[model samples]
Target: MSILMHVCTLVIKILVLPLQVAELLGLYQLYKRVFPVFIYNISFSYNSKMNDKKRELFRELLRFSPRAGPLRLLEVGCGSGANFQHYPSGCRITCTDPNPHFKEYLQKNMDKSDHLVYEKFVVAPGEDLRAVEDNSVDVVVCTLVLCSVSNAPKVIQEAKRVLRPGGAFFFLEHVVDEPSTWTYFFQHVFQPFMYYLGDGCEITRATWKHIEAAGFSDLKLLHFQAPLVFLIRPHISGYAVK
Candidate 1:
């Protein structure tokens, strides 16, 4: 088993050698352009497979009524607007993503979901959301994002900053499993390959810890195992109130 795992890892690395070379040669623009297309294709199947679980979770977290008027939402790392269907009707959503290439796909999703109001898409990392005003949004949503960020804590802080007092930060992310688990062992083994193929996603991050330390007034986080690839099955989902 050990030898087989090593061989599989080697095979995966060999397949991604071109990506490694691109990075080494500073072909960042090419990487940025290609990654969104890669994720957009993969997300269709992934979303379909995780549809029930994700739909239920989104419904629960986004259930709250705003104090007044339509709910204002800011989603960090809003790749291809995957959560559009789950949002309540008349939601005013501002989408942000580091990759500009996703805007085209995002617009298509927005056009399909006419029930929700579409705000402009901003090209910004979650760690620095300077374009969004402080305390301006009713809810901040992040899904499958923390793992790829260079600094999870900074992203959470920015999320909290943009949310109105009493607004909520809703998050759903895959995290590292327990140390003794076989999944955890493999997560570490294939992490480098995943980091490249996934456009900086790190499977072994303990993302829940960053949220816990963000000083939310109230937090309700839970852990579960998603029916996904073994390396990314362990997951966390819930909300934190500012």
Candidate 2:
């Protein structure tokens, strides 16, 4: 089994050699351009597989009174707007992502969801949400994002900063498995490769810790195993009230 794993990892590395070369040559713009296309092509299949559980979670977390008019929602790392369908009707969504290439895909999804009110998409990382005003949004959301950020704590703090009093910050992220587990072994083994291939996603990050220490007034987090690859099976999902 050990030998097989090593062989598999080698084959994966070889397959991504071109990307490594591109990065070495400072062709980061190439990566930025390609990654969104790659994600756009695969997002439909990925979302279809994860829809049942994610839909339920979004429904629960996004519940708000219509009496408040449209809810103001800001989603960081809003890749291709995968969560747009799950949002409640009449949400004024402000989408942010570092990759500008995703805007085209995001607009396509937005067009499909006529119920949602589209606010402009901003090009920004989760760590720095300077374009968004403090305490301006009713909800902040990030799904499958924390693992790739440069600083998870900074992202969580930014989420808290943009949310109004009593607003919720919703997150659904994959986390590292416990030590001594086979999955943990695999996660570490493939992490370096995944970091490059996933554009900085680190499978072994304990993202829940950052969220816990973000000083939210109330937090409700739960852990579960998602039906994903072995390296990313362990997942966390919930909301923190600011």
Residue by residue across 151-200, what tens digits does model 2's lDDT show? 89999999999998888999999999987688976886787688887888
Candidate 1 stretches with Cα past 4 Å from truth are 1-19, 61-63
How much lDDT does each candidate structure score?
Answer: 0.88, 0.87
lDDT of 1 by residue, 1-242 (tens): 56766777787788878878888898856777887778778888878977887787778644555757898999999999888888988899999999989999898899999999998899999999999999999899999999999999999999999998988999989999998788977987788788987889999999999999999999989899988888899999889999
- Model 2, C-alpha of 40: deviation from truth (Å): 1.5
Clashes of 1: 0
Which sections of candidate 2 miss by over 4 Å? 1-21, 62-67
Estimate the overall C-alpha local distance difference test score of candidate 1: 0.88
Scored by lDDT, model 2 comes in at 0.87
Which number leads on lDDT?
1
Worst 10 residues of 1 by lDDT: 59-68
